[model samples]
Target: MGIQEIAQATGLSKATVSRALRGLPTVAGSTVDQVRRVADELGYVPSSAAAGLATGRQRAVGVVLPVIDRWFTAKALGGVDAELRAAGYDLVLYNLGGPGGDRHRAFRRAMLRQRVDALVLLSLVLDETERRELQVSELPTVVIGGPAHDLRNVGVDDHEVAALAVAHLTGLGHREVAYVGGEDEAGFTVAVPYLRRDGFTEAMARAGAPVRADRYADGRFSFAGGVAAGAVLLEVPAPDRPTAVVCASDEMALGVVVAAHRLGLEVPRDVSVTGVDGHEYGEVLGLTTVAQDPEAQGRVAARTVVLEAQGASPGPLPPSAARLVVRRTTAGPCR
Candidate 1:
């Protein structure tokens, strides 16, 4: 039923009904209660678009991600979705995947169409032109896991996450540990893999552990990539082989686990493994990791963008941090 019918049933004016439905302070609390009761009885639903037009907002925020299939990205997006919905906002997802050509075209043609009030970019590696295009919207934008730019962003220090992984292995009595990470450096321009590697090196140095150049492997941030890295790591001669491995993501860690089992190497008993990003499967694998609340990050980014759209300054975006979560993935040095 329409607002007018609800108003008639409640014996309230249409204006008062609209105000009550919107939960405006101008409407008396009793009248709002009465309107809500009658509206519920009639199964009335308000049009968010109509309300948005009246308020000069769409009540919707846009989220752009490089790929939706990855675990980390999906988890982060999930968090953003919960936070925005709780605040009476909607999210519009934009997947900007593909090579530079298709990605650039999507950004220019579709994402900047002024459809969303504000934008949240999740782990999207935007070039100079794309950054300029985003700025053209003049909408409040928050970026997650992004390079340092003029726009506000929220994400953990990737380097620190990597360091924690490596540090945990070293602390578990592992002197010879290998680091594996993604080969694509485009996303690393924001210092993802490189910083993570830096953290690993720093941790090893601090622990006085030996750093083996051959132990470091570069692969994609996928299960196959992890398998490839694990194969190479397991191939090192017996005495020189790394007793532990540090992976950039849990997906890679799982791959390593699978590879280890195939190679007849038992985890934690023969060799230990740790990873970054507290994926759901990490607990199942008993993988030690550095956990960052991806959902919380998404929520914060959404809130920041919404506030910006409302012409309210959200101040500066807070720097994200990582915490170490110890699990059964690492153990004492093998004799």
Candidate 2:
């Protein structure tokens, strides 16, 4: 019913019940649990508006993303949602439609209605104008899958991930390696595609298996794009074709596998294929990859913002883990 009823049931003062309900750090853990049990027994429903009036916090977190349909974005979003829900915080999602979505309107300072206590951004590089607007809000902010300029980030190190993938291929004695990555799409501010590509190039150079200019093709970070890029790279003469191919995403890697089948090229024997991202389909397809957990990244981002919102100064986050998963698609070059 209300804090007053809960306080009576628990024999605790209304002030203690209120503090426990808000989950303030100053409240003792055992007392907080006792208050919650009594409150639940009394069917008490905490009101967000009342909480906001008391604490000047909206009890909500805003999540901003460029799109919603992709595998990584969706998974990360789920993770963020779960964490926020567990913390008794509402999620306010702000989808920017897609690559061509209205940038000016979304980042306008007036668009933020002061309805959220904090913000979690997913892999978007903000320009100067957008940055200023966020600064004006001054909400505790963190980015998932992105390490943009001076923003707290929660994701794998793109450079380290790329190098790990490349090292795996080169260790298998594959010298002629090709790369499949995309450019930042028009109206999109993602830095991952280029970061992975450059990391791949630099890793190859370090391994003494430098990639040729013609050996690289833009996969556009999609299945169709991967298929097209794979075809161009694999359709060449045997001697001229790369013995290994590294894709920036699992969707693209799966596409390359399809392209290989169509071109009558045997994986590992003809060309070893690798990818980044541990997409759900990757396991079924048996594709080797540098797997990083987007869902986990999302959870970390949400937790960090929630803590910061609660007046806790969390330290800098270490990069999320990324490890290579060797599967049937890659083996020592048999060519």
Q: How close is candidate 1 to the true structure, as a TM-score?
A: 0.78
Best by lDDT: 2
* TM-score of each candidate structure, all chains considered together: 0.78, 0.81
Model 2 regions more than 4 Å off? 1-56, 104-106, 109-111, 184-188
RMSD of each: 11.1, 11.2
Candidate 2 C-alpha lDDT tens digits along 148-190: 7888889888999999999999998989999998864533346
For model 2, state the Cα shift of residue 116 in Å.
0.8
Q: All models: lDDT? A: 0.75, 0.83
User: For model 1, what is the alpha-carbon lDDT of residue 133?
Assistant: 69
RMSD of 1: 11.1
Q: Extract clashing residue pairs from model 2.
A: none
